[model samples]
Target chain A: MAHRWKNDLTRADATPYAAFMNRRQLMGGALGLGLIGAAGAARAAEELVPNSWEDITQYNNYYEFGTRKDDPARNAHTLTTSPWTVKIDGLVDNPGDYSMAQILDAMTIEERIYRFRCVEAWSMVIPWNGFELADLLTMAGVQDGAKYVAFETALRPDEMPGVSYPVLDWPYVEGLRLDEAMHPLTMMATGIYGKTIPNQNGAPMRLVVPWKYGFKSIKSIVRITLTEDEPPTSWNKANAREYGFYSNVNPEVDHPRWSQASERLVGGGLFARRQPTLMFNGYADEVASLYEGMDLSKFI
Target chain B: MSIADRINPLARKLPTWVVYVLYLLPVPVLLYMAQTGGLGREPVKALEHELGEIAIQLLIIGLCISPLRRFAGVNLLKFRRAFGILAFVYVVLHLLVWAVLDVQTLERVWADIVKRPYITVGMGAFVLMLPLIATSNNRAVRWLGPLWRQVHLLTYPVVLLAAVHFIWVRKGFQIEPILYLAVIGGLLALRLIPKRARVAA
Candidate 1:
């Protein structure tokens, strides 16, 4: 009952992380209560975050925690949330483990609204409040042999029952090419809805690779390893066809199973209709330059 | 002959109440359709959610019978035929919903079953249930004898497949489905474990 209705139009463009969190805490963070009272008021207004509440909950592609829309929301609670640490190692020159508290203290978290696209053909525009992934790499000190940046989640099968699945090797792993990892659009998310990330959402740490499918945004990261060769990714090794190494959102490269032309917007009614999925999920202007002339079909 | 003597003897001899109940056995599916907007406005997702749920529930009911008759000393064997068919009905609905609404194409559907591990398992379960459902009548049961029970034991594989299907459909694993899987798994395991078997093997 802390937040019932919000007048989003007149509110701060980017509320301080603490101020936004304080209001969100009062409102209980149930999508749109404090942020949006009516639909049409901001019809033509510019928003930093691209997602609506329905899209946020419905298009969940959080594979690091588990495979259900609500699974991560449930099992991710046991993460040793605060006082977190990230090990920055491998081919990096300044290889060391840094404390989560230190990272937060050293950096200013910003609010950037992004449209999230799932490979399953759904999309959401979410306003993520976090620091940049590049800033962290700069802080970590990347070196020459670092061709790939690999991320690892905490491997606590006891706490997370999903790890019991012999589907693949435990300790969910995701990786990015060094250039992709350091892209400006790629973020290191710490909070959402202007508040500290809730327990179900990967807290303490996670990466946000905008321009790629949602799964590429790894979560609950405990280790960051910069490698010379392409790191062996968890999904590609598990099911190579449905998931790919690049896993970028490309309409030309249809998933082995489903159509990429359409998407079911969550919270949008069944038959409520879906929108056309864009190439690189509408971030083509900013990131398309990086993949220019590369055959997405072959790369995919 | 007196007018009363003209009544058909078959009607007089048959268990009219049993026939009526048997004919009305599809009430669960009917009720489910009505409650979930199967005939209402929010048709597709509503239909999808209901069918998925019913598919699992029907499978649960199918698994419940042997245990019920064994542990509870109950004669719920009477409803097993109807319930198994109900499970089939729900599964078909689940498939149809996925096919017509969820995936939306024959090529995509076939590719999905072939490409995805869970979809293959689900289709396998669906295929195995067909013969059991086709042979539901007493005549077929009597004809097949012990082979009928052996074929029906296919339910165990079906249960496993359904659980896998549930687990893999979402991008992340959900504990709710896992809990159901655990219960169904334990119960199915109980039926087979030699140490736990109390009835004459």
Candidate 2:
């Protein structure tokens, strides 16, 4: 717990459910800690909220459900998260489809309050319950040659509408350098706020890499493939010029479409000033060393 | 009777200031929505987008007036000034919102205008419309005579640039923006038809 960075945002930062939903009649501010999946350990400044469960669950960029932000909340309920299985293959000594329950049973879970920065430049602070990704890689027995970790999200066309759009080649894929994958801060989140993650927010299991843009944290993952070579990521494949594989939150490196210098905080109210974006989304102190000599602008 | 004959009397019955207020109603509505948190998650961004879209839509509608009269026999001339002025005002407000609220950094706003192609094109459209906005009054129209009409013709290029700005600012293949471009292109194409051919048809 001492090593884990804590967010200072308390329950006060969260918008009440009624206000968040834009209901005309304001409701009493009831702190719904029901969503906190595990016992809370960190004390956070009231700078970031878990974005009110309604905001977290309702507004999402799960393209699997649809392209519009609200599409997932409306469409993802049909997804069967229970009885889910993840195929761990490639450079791991143990290669098989392990049930979600089996994987959770084998790991220790902790609550982590992390800033969720999107490549689109909006951000959120989420309280996630999960175990470090390193633990899972360790359990699977990473082979000596593995240099990168590739991940694939579920590709259920019958369930996920956006797959129909050629937004990207489907069975959405992402990867992290082996070192990045094994970073202590990188976790496989199972729940948010203190409850089982809602369907739209990638229920059952998802990846949370705070230092990188939100896209790098692939959601509703069904496959984890360790490899010796760099793996193709979804966005980088969609547009190489805009989305780089690393996708680290660097204010200096602008997205070709928009500036990465500042981000509008989700739930920050209409007139809330956009805060300056931090280098590596303020995790530069921890993760900057990982890309010590790499030319980020070129790589990006 | 022609639409111009019938509607001209009805339009004349309405006072100019009342028409102006009616034309400019969306400003207060947008401001109210912004204050009340009705603009959704990112309200400023939403407001900026809505205002910009409204400005472009009005610009397109303003461009459509002549073509509508020429091809369809619908005379909306009396309202064109209202449309153009409201569009210009909205564009100014949209730019201000981006600068004062969205960007909040003078240096960044300047950089965005200079460096970004979409912003550059958008700013170009606004600057092109400035003279048109300035000379919108009756006195300027009377003084400039035919030369005023020639300067107002800048609307064509401004529409094209604004439409291109709208298209360029979006990410990926968005159908709505392409549809907007198609509408603008259709209006511009209608203007290209010979006057006698349009009348005969």
Candidate 3:
């Protein structure tokens, strides 16, 4: 059966490609419009200016490429995404090396414009083209005992320089509760801005859990396992104190090193003021029920 | 004339106000970058990082003055005060950029300072430098006598803390921050050698 969930967010929320490039022009227009409706229109205008392909592709924190923000863009182009294959194993019935083309054929794709919040307290609004993770999970036939869904990225040491430095355990891993994995909002992105996903932005395939901090949406995935036990994530395993098992974007539950109360919006240009971070990255109404009564601060 | 000798006479002729103007030059360039969308995606973060880097560079340059005078016979002691003042200015600006623009809340700023180890060390370094910056004048140098020298010894520890702060703030084993720590360590090592051994060498 096809996934029946309807995305409430529409194309209207997405910034046009030309408008994103000409943001200064848009800002000037917004300023003129700001006078008509006062502060509210100006604030709304600020939200519409999306990150450029250059910004999205360049300023990424893919530790697999390297630790520096620019390293991914500099190094990821060498990644051989064309012949990629995903190994679906563990509690699933259908388990094998599914080619990228095969995976794309298995599900229906759609575009989603989402506010992406990173654990480092930076954010961007991206228009991603992908299908729900549940659709693919269902296609694979998730077994009854599976309580969690674990994902892994490719560990090509020669191609990925940062892997050599032990920045993270090679073949970076991430997981979600079975329920969270099955949620309609959980996505497997293949492209951005209506183009094939850039190498630095996780080429071929990647996860996009909008409510969680961006790291939770692991990049360049090659293996996905349906497990009965909770899987060890990369950052959480590296430093448990700094990164929690559930890396939800919560303003109240601050990261040990920095405040999560606010995030600097990317592409806002110089002097861009920080915007207050929302609970579950403003998807509390949709995703909050998944956690229920659990203490987020402790989990965080 | 050699580069040092050539620069010395011009440096002597220039007014003290030149130091202030030279350091302040980066401010407008950064502002222009911000306005023209040259700071890439996160402009505020870029500005804050640039300011912090400048502060650290200035502090390192200030530490180098003594070694240059000793080894190279270039006495730039007159501009030493200017370097310290400008470094302090950049430090204050970096902190303000983080507090006002990045964090955007007084409560959050205090929370970060208290909870974050990097912030704690960075703030501690700033506090240690406060008395040194305050006493960097002719009046304080003459009035306090040898007590002023004792108080100014805080510079060594303050610089160490600042270097440690830079290391702690990085995400991974980045070489840049480690390089900074090595530079500071080398400067401190130079200071440790006996004056008699140094002169003989």
TM-score of chain B of each: 0.75, 0.92, 0.94
> Candidate 1 lDDT, tens digit per residue, B1-201?
533244334335555356436534554665466455443333455567667776787788778877765665444566677778778877887788778776665776887788767778889989988988889889999999989989888888888888877776654335667877898998888787574445455
Interface RMSD of each: 6.3, 2.1, 2.0
**Which scores better on TM-score, 1 or 2?**
2
CAPRI grade of model 3: medium
Interface DockQ of each model: 0.14, 0.35, 0.52
Native contact fraction, candidates in order: 0.14, 0.37, 0.67
Tens digits of per-residue lDDT for model 2, B121-193? 9999999999999999999999999999999999999989988998887655555678899999988887777
Residue B109's lDDT in candidate 2: 92
* Rank order (by TM-score, best first): 3, 2, 1
Stretches of candidate 1 off by over 4 Å are A1-49, A52-67, A157-161, A164-167, B1-50, B56-77, B99-101, B104-201
**lDDT per residue as tens, model 3, B91-156:** 999999888877766877898899998999999999988999889999999999999979987888
Between candidates 2 and 3, which one is better according to DockQ?
3
| lDDT (tens digit, per residue) of candidate 1 on A1-300 | 111212233235655689757754554452335333222222224334355543453334454456555666656667677677899999877788789988887776876667677777776667777887878887878988788999987787666766777545677798999998887788888887787876555676778877888878877789999889988777787778678888888877877655685565555444443455667876676778888898888887
Residue A230 shift from truth in candidate 2, angstroms:
1.5
The 10-residue segment of model 3 chain A with minimum total lDDT is A36-45
